[model samples]
Target: MAFLVVSRYSPLFAILFVASLAGLHCESPGKSPAFSFRFERFEKNRSLDAVIALYGDAEISDFVVGITRPAVFSSGRVVYRKPVRFLGRNPSFSTYFAFSVSSPDGGEGLAFFLAPSSSPVKESTNGLHFGLPPGATAVKFETRTEPETGSHIRVEVGGEISKQSSNLSNVSLVLHGGEKVHSWVDYDGDSKRFEVRLSKSSDSRPLSPLVSYPIDLSRVLQREEKLVGISSSSGNSTQTSSVYSWSFAVKRGAPYSMHSEPLDPRPFVVRARESPPIHLRRTYPWGVFVAMVFAAACGGLLTFFVMFVWFALIARRPVAPVEYPVHPVEVGYQQIELVAGEKGVDSTKK
Candidate 1:
């Protein structure tokens, strides 16, 4: 009966083995391609400028380069230009190219803006290059020296600079030491607004919100126009600066709607999708497998021995006899009736 029971359930082991193989066959979905760019050097002397033509209709310009002189004395200078068109029908946007720079003296810094003309401007005296024209919404992140504030970093939105804190304030976002920082401005079509955010690779913190403003696409210039590139400068004090890389992405028509309604979308499939089966041909190493098998067998044998000993102890216990012994006194007190019977027989005989 035990053998029949074991045989009846043996197929379940095969089913579990097949289920494990099936689990490994499922694969993850694909992902979109990442867009990026890197620039080794950008200098007015080098005449290097990076440009991104947006869907062939608009252009985003970036100026990146090193400066020999600082912004204080006006020895170092950088400039960039590209043709752009804002037809007043499509949304056009611009930002100072984001880059990482290390200065020997840490004197002056960088800027981003859209100029009436394509020519590059000199580094401002009070870090004013970041401020945009009147009625223009712009944000600037600057790190420099101040008379009352000393050395600090900040973000300027619409020419208003927020107080500096170790935490990410309104302008400059805190980046983890030893990691790159990235920030961007995005136009959302569904919301019909522009949103700005900053991100750091080393920090796991949530994106820092700069600001959200309405997009007035009609304000942008029409016909062919030039887009400005990223620029940086040092003060009169000698210092070397460099920009590693920068890039931009633009969508022509209305901004794509990224929002989606929540749905399970799982039970609607009718056909069972087939996939290439995973093949697991390799087994444990011969020596280790043999050792494991031997150890398991020894463990099972030990258990059997323990059970046999327990059953033997229960079966061999001595049991008491049912009858009791008669006392010597009772035996000695036996009646003399036997003798009386004999005497009667003798008198009859006499």
Candidate 2:
């Protein structure tokens, strides 16, 4: 009886075996164009800026990108357009952003990154811990471990002095894959502080910051310009995640709006803000040996602009209103009888 049953179902078992082998054949990560990863702007539906995506092994039938597109069986990355003032020579600056990441059954996890624009993305690697490629600085949220998946912050420059710290309290880094998590990364150069925070509400104050990092913006920002983005990777189990929305803003007076800073729209500048005031480094002529003399002459374009602005802001006194005097009018008809003496004399003489 058992032999008869085995022989009857032999074809079904063979078909299932063939399908499993095919999945393994296409399971190569970071390679193969047929299973290639996608990085692109998410323009339709809910107004998000970008995305990185991949489908399950041999599961590429209906891959979607924008809001309406299902984020099923996808693993991808996305970055913002513009670069803000990360660091500088003299004056320092700070920036803050708000973003949301959603993953139902966490795979590799999400990452927030600040990468130099010059580096190309093709050379990057993928995994839960190393969400970003090698050429950038990143803070990754790892959700694939046993006890408690950890979130880490890291910076790597020219493959030297690379370090990552998970010293943050796990409570602060709490996240769930299916539900949306609201996160914020703040880099305040003025305070010399770097921190990450998450919240349930958009308007809520940062809940005990997940982690705090003390970074010297000047050193971390090797390049003057950098891009803000996110990345994630999954295991063979197959996973998908999406960046719901992202807003990049530089702190101005009274906090700026989401669009306060846009990825540099110009291809060449790439998220660069307005250029800084010009600096003239040329030396003085032989006739003027003193440094002050050279500095006075160096006030070419920038110095003039500063002076113009100063004068323009000065308030001018209001002019006095003009006054016109008003006079009374009198009208009367003169009688001709009183003036007849001269006229009568002329008539009588005639």
lDDT of 1 by residue, 193-287 (tens): 65544454333223434555564434433323434334344444333333334433333433323223221212111223332111112234664
Worst 10 residues of 1 by lDDT: 52-61
- The model with the greatest lDDT is 2
Positional deviation of residue 33's Cα in model 2 after best superposition, in angstroms: 40
At residue 112, candidate 2 shows an lDDT of 64
Per-candidate Cα RMSD to the true structure, in Å, reads: 25.6, 31.4
lDDT scores for all predictions? 0.38, 0.43
- Displacement of residue 340 (Cα, Å) in model 2 is 72
TM-score of each: 0.40, 0.45
Q: What lDDT tens digits, residue by residue, belong to model 2 across residues 97-136? A: 3333344454555566667776554343533333464566
How many clashes would you count in candidate 1? Answer: 13
